[model samples]
Target: MSATTTSPRISPVNPALATPTDLSSEGVAAIADQLRDLLADVFALYVKTKNFHWHMSGPHFRDSHLLLDEHSDQIFAMTDELAERARKIGGTTLRSIGDIARHQRLRDNDKEFVEPRTMLAELASDNQELTRSLRAAHAVCDEHQDVATTSLIENWIDETERRTWFLSEIAGPR
Candidate 1:
């Protein structure tokens, strides 16, 4: 007697070659939305941090400015990574400041010469916003079962959370 074997069906990924049948369409979309939201938050925070870095004034001016600039650069890099991931998953990353302003939970004061303490407060709040956005993105990634993206986001979230805590401490228990 001959044994019969069956092959598992393969799904196409290219939207051009055949009908796109993403097994995790809902998941991918959710992940995409979350990433987009995170991107906006990070971009806003990056700009805010840079602004404060340039305008911060106090006895700690030099130290605070340098740190803020470093943090802003890191945040910008994180934003780029998230945007690249979105594009990798066939989703467009939102780049406009208007889009960021619309989606951001944080506000900017845009001061010409803000006090160092005030800059610290603003940076703290912005970092907290970044934390919130990252956590939401992690949840969305979990929903989509995107482990790679999820892992990358976890590192970012942890770093942002730590930075927020440090800033909050400097802001004196607020």
Candidate 2:
């Protein structure tokens, strides 16, 4: 005798998880795609920031460490807001770290050691790139008339700019 095995059947679309929205399906798709990519970049930066924080060492180690810790916290906080925003608009989000890797546009650092100034400089550049991405996402929201997402992106752009400014100041002319 042989036991029969079957895989659970799933629907092509899960209406239950899809929140109600007034936006057109096309708008939802566009917004969701942008948000997913944005979230991916945010997550990548967060990890890199934390990595630098953990590995920070220098004359100003304490200050640099604290700064990166703060930056990482701020970056991590956005993950939930972004994911939820996508869901609120009748869309899905990333499922795993691999999903994030697949969507992220930011580069990761895997060096055994990174100079404190170098870390600061790299993070600053990444934050600048993030600001650009935020603007792009905001443009999508504008096209879709997504005021809620636009508002969120505006605040995020400010925060990203602040992060970039701090990193640059700390890194200084080196």
Candidate 2 lDDT? 0.88
Candidate 1 residue-wise lDDT, 1-174, digit = tens: 000111112222346422232526555556666777678778778888888877777777887878888888888889879877876765555757787776666677755677777778778888877776677667667766778888998899788987787777776755
| Stretches of model 2 off by over 4 angstroms after superposition | 1-13
lDDT of 1: 0.71
TM-score of 2: 0.92
Error of 1 at 95 (Å): 4.2
Least lDDT summed over 10 consecutive residues: which range in candidate 1?
A: 1-10
Q: After superposition, how far is residue 58 of candidate 1 from its true place, in Å?
A: 1.1
Listed per candidate, the RMSD to the true structure in angstroms reads 10.2, 8.9
Which candidate ranks first by TM-score, i.e. highest? 2
How high is the lDDT of residue 18 in model 2?
Answer: 75
Error of 2 at 130 (Å): 0.3
lDDT of 2 by residue, 1-174 (tens): 000111112222277787889987777877888888889999999999999999999899999999999999999999999999989988788889999998899999999999999999999999999999999889888888999999999999999999999999989985
